[model samples]
Target chain A: GIQVEQSPPDLILQEGANSTLRCNFSDSVNNLQWFHQNPWGQLINLFYIPSGTKQNGRLSATTVATERYSLLYISSSQTTDSGVYFCAVLGGTYKYIFGTGTRLKVLA
Target chain B: SQTIHQWPATLVQPVGSPLSLECTVEGTSNPNLYWYRQAAGRGLQLLFYSVGIGQISSEVPQNLSASRPQDRQFILSSKKLLLSDSGFYLCAWSEIAGSREQYFGPGTRLTVT
Candidate 1:
């Protein structure tokens, strides 16, 4: 069994601010992804960075396999980014174990 | 273009009642399907997954069951629901197995009363 831990379970940011979220896994992972669960409960895929770095718009993510951790960075945050951010790793048995999520509230 | 569909945005059922949730994918073939449940403000928990029709693997031992009648269709069923069954159910699909990014459906919210 693999365990995932997300730091700072709760977060609040102001518009135009910057923030970073971290995810640590207990074991090796073949796949990793970040998702944003909107207020409507829709799980929207954010990034699929198992290793290396990727950037989409004002968001970026990096995963270090050896370290067994990933970091998601948000720059110039917007109100639409206000939601629960989830980090999931595809580990043993090909199942994804999601983190508790970091609830982000961006105040305008 | 690929898309996942999950039905019945919301449901309220009684204990011991039968439960069925349907998920279908469009414009994709031989995709791996999975079922996950999430408690209020919590993480997603893997329920089951199928790589092909009539093939299923359960992760957690529970009252839940899953079936795939078509390459693009997946169904989750339960013979008897429990109060703990109340949660948000999400159906997801990926191109292949193990390590592929999953595309999730809108999700189904169920409340076992």
Candidate 2:
């Protein structure tokens, strides 16, 4: 089983601000995904970046597979972004391990 | 387009009661299905996964069990619920081709009194 750790367990930002979240895995992973669990408890897929970088609107993610780390960037944050951000990875099995998550609060 | 569904948006039951949660996927075949639990202010924990009909793999040894009687249906059951079983249960599915990205269902919020 691989270990997943997310940094900055909690974050608060003003509207239109920017922030970054990091995830570190203990070993090699064949799959990595970023998810946003909104206030309504719906887990929305953000990115499926096993490696390299990807962007969708004001959100972008970069995965350095060789370094066993990934970063998620949110620019011009909105109040709608207030929720939990999760990083999950699949390593050597069908099971996906998730980090404790980063809780974000964007104040309007 | 593939869509996952979960029923009983919320549930409240007494301790020792039997529990059953259902998940179904549409527009896909032979997809991989998974069950996860998220406790309050906590992370997601893998409970069970199925690659096909009648093929279930439990990640954690608990009172909970899962079954896949059909290709697109998954069921999570508990003979007797515990107070600790109160949490948000989610069902997810991914492609059978080994892709890691998974689409999650709306989730069910269960509370055991």
lDDT per residue for candidate 2 within B6-105, as digits (tens), equals 9888999999999999999999999999999999999999999999899999888999999999999999999999999999999999987857579999
Quote fnat for model 1: 0.87
Residue range B1-113, candidate 1, lDDT tens digits: 99899998999999999999999999988998999999998889999988888999998999999999989999999999999999999999998754578999999999998
User: For model 2, how does the per-residue alpha-carbon lDDT over A1-108 read when each residue is reduced to its tens digit?
Assistant: 799999999999999999999999999999999999998899999999999999999999999999999999999999999999999999776878999999999999
In terms of docking quality, model 2 is: high
**DockQ each:** 0.81, 0.89
The per-prediction i-RMS, to one decimal, reads 1.2, 0.8
Cα-based TM-score, every candidate: 0.96, 0.98
Instruction: Output the TM-score of candidate 2.
Output: 0.98
Q: Give the best candidate by lDDT.
A: 2
Error of 1 at B72 (Å): 0.9
Per-residue error (Å), model 1, residue B24 = 0.2
Error of 2 at B12 (Å): 0.5
Each model's lDDT: 0.93, 0.95
